[model samples]
Target: MTFVPSPSPPAVRQPGATALFCLPGAGASAGLFAGWDEDLPATIEAFALEPAGHGLRTDEEPHTDLDTLLADLMDAVRPYAGRPLALLGHSFGAVLAFELALRLEREGTPVRHVFPVAARAAAVRTGSPPGREPTDEELKARLRALGGTPAPVLDDEEMFALLLPALRADFELTDAYRYRAGDLLDCPVTAFAGADDTVVPWASVKAWGACTRGRFTVHRVPGGHFFPFAHRSARADLLRTLAQELDRRPGTAPRRPDTPEHG
Candidate 1:
């Protein structure tokens, strides 16, 4: 299926501004990050990268292949990369962010930092089986376990039907993913996870360090897998801290491997 990215809203971009692209999890749209940028500094511009089959692009078919989805995402973000950039992805989106960072690194347009929220590191080994579309009960159980799906939506058959295709495709995509050995990123990596997350353990989160030659830190928020959505105040505090940290960095393009200093 082809992908269509929603148009970005008109905005006045400040000079030397950092674009913080946030990606949502499975079955979710960019709307998931609505108002997330409100607390950030003016220098940090937060944009939600919505995938096909969700949000404004709900009419479009969802993607199943990783390569194609990445290509579409790259195309969508390329225009915004003229300035300094960062990436933050939650859950399934975090996997996308990880691969996107690798692609950007290879293309010599690496982002300043990558914050993978509620996701396991690529190098982490798990005993879990490969992913596939789940049965209704299985899907329901998963949604219940994560505690992200609202009761009203879960109770509504029509709503669940509308959501399943993209949700299933995303699960399949995550299941099909295989971690290949690759060069470590020059950019720093920060991982976020819920302290009580059974889906992604601390070891899996810590494994992100192996993916980067630069600094790596892991922050644990109090809650379960969908902690950010459940605990808004804490999430806001975290974002503010991120804004301060980004402000501390030099006003330059993201470091590329081909650059003389990095070389």
Candidate 2:
């Protein structure tokens, strides 16, 4: 699959500025984090990454396998290697973030942290049971239950038809995933769970601590599955906590230099 050219990084960055990469859940696009830059601290630069058949690549076919998706995502993110990196993903995206973190660390690029929001731990089995592929109507019902997609969009035949492919592909990938034991991540992990989410239990969210050898923290934010975007105040609090965590990391603070910057 073809990817858009990577944007050029700024010639100058506040010393130790982090490159924050974000991934969205199933049936969603990078547009999920459209206004996140305004909400994030200047020390953090947020880049939203979308899988094929979503957002700008809406015409492309989505992948039903994890390896292919990760390969493309690795290519998309490798250009930002110069800066300290962290990843934050919601639901399906959260699983991708975890896998990506493992890949990056294996290649000798240490990740600063990982934020898995509203997702069960990687080791836990999710998605549909064996041999069962959810029908389009079942998918729509799941979307309605999550309440992330608008009622109007679901009601619009043309719009929902366009969205169905990626949704199906994402579920396929999620269902096929089987965690293989390996080295635990050295970076800290902060897992977030919606206090009222019925889809993924609190115990499942808390299980993320096992993925990391570094510090592990869990935050119970208010709202349901889509809390990161659905609730304004909760989103703000989440970002604030993210900034605070980054700030606490040594050498990640902005530093002024007398020299003219060049990338």
Candidate 3:
């Protein structure tokens, strides 16, 4: 895959506050996290990490290699190490979130927690076999099944064509991803899944516990692959509960500059 330098969305940083970094699913961008700030209290600042070749960066080519894409994201996030950080990823984004969390922990960055939604556990092998590529029609059909894509966009030939490259690149990244075994994370992990999601089952979501030595919890929401938006009320309550839970945890405030930032 060709490396394309895309414009990054503005960083979300608030002095002396916890920051929540979100990763969107395949073929999606930071726009996936619309209205997150309103759902949570002021103490927690939410920012979405927009993947390259999508969202406002649509003109650029997407990175097909997981490592390259992650390296760029790591650099963007490294500066925020002094703050209490938590990660939230949905679907394919979940995989990215898991890998990012591990990298941060290994580098002695303090990661408060990780939330993997609508995805399998890190130990679970995901993606297509090497060199196998799905056709555009097949990809469209899969997207239709997932119900995340709008009907009009899928039906519009011109728009769909424009969306194909980034979509395909994301497929390559996820389908080609190979899991590397590593130590369980020291921070807590919360996994969420759609009870009716045919693609990723509830059992797969529960398996996220194996990736973390810290507290592990899982909640199944109603609807298909995109349950969060489908059931807004339920999702709001869940997110509000998450915020409260994080608030209750001791020492969630941003670390002092003089204090060690690692666990």
lDDT per residue as tens, model 3, 1-263: 01112244344445667878888888887777887777877778877787778886887678888888999778867767888988889898988888899899999998888888888787786556687578989989977887888999999999999889988988778777767676578887877777778999777788788787777767776666887766667568658756865766744543221111110
What stretches of model 2 exceed 4 Å from their correct place?
1-15, 126-132, 250-263
Q: Which portions of model 3 show Cα errors greater than 4 Å?
A: 1-14, 250-263
lDDT by residue (9-57, candidate 1, tens digit) is 3454677778888888877878878778777787888888888777777
The CA lDDT of each predicted structure is: 0.75, 0.81, 0.76
Rank candidates, lDDT, best first: 2, 3, 1
Which structure among the candidates has the greatest TM-score?
2
Residue pairs of candidate 3 with colliding backbone atoms: 127-175
Q: How does each model score on TM-score?
A: 0.87, 0.88, 0.87
Model 2 TM-score, all chains together: 0.88
Cα displacement (angstroms), candidate 2, residue 180, comes to 1.0
184 Cα displacement, candidate 3 (Å):
2.4
lDDT of 3: 0.76
Instruction: Give per-residue CA lDDT, model 2, range 1-263, as digits (tens).
Output: 11222455445355777888899888898888877777787798788887888988887899887899999899888877778999999997988999999999999997998999999898776455568778889989987886789999999989999999999988788777777776478888878888888888988888887787777778886778888798667777888888887778644433221111111
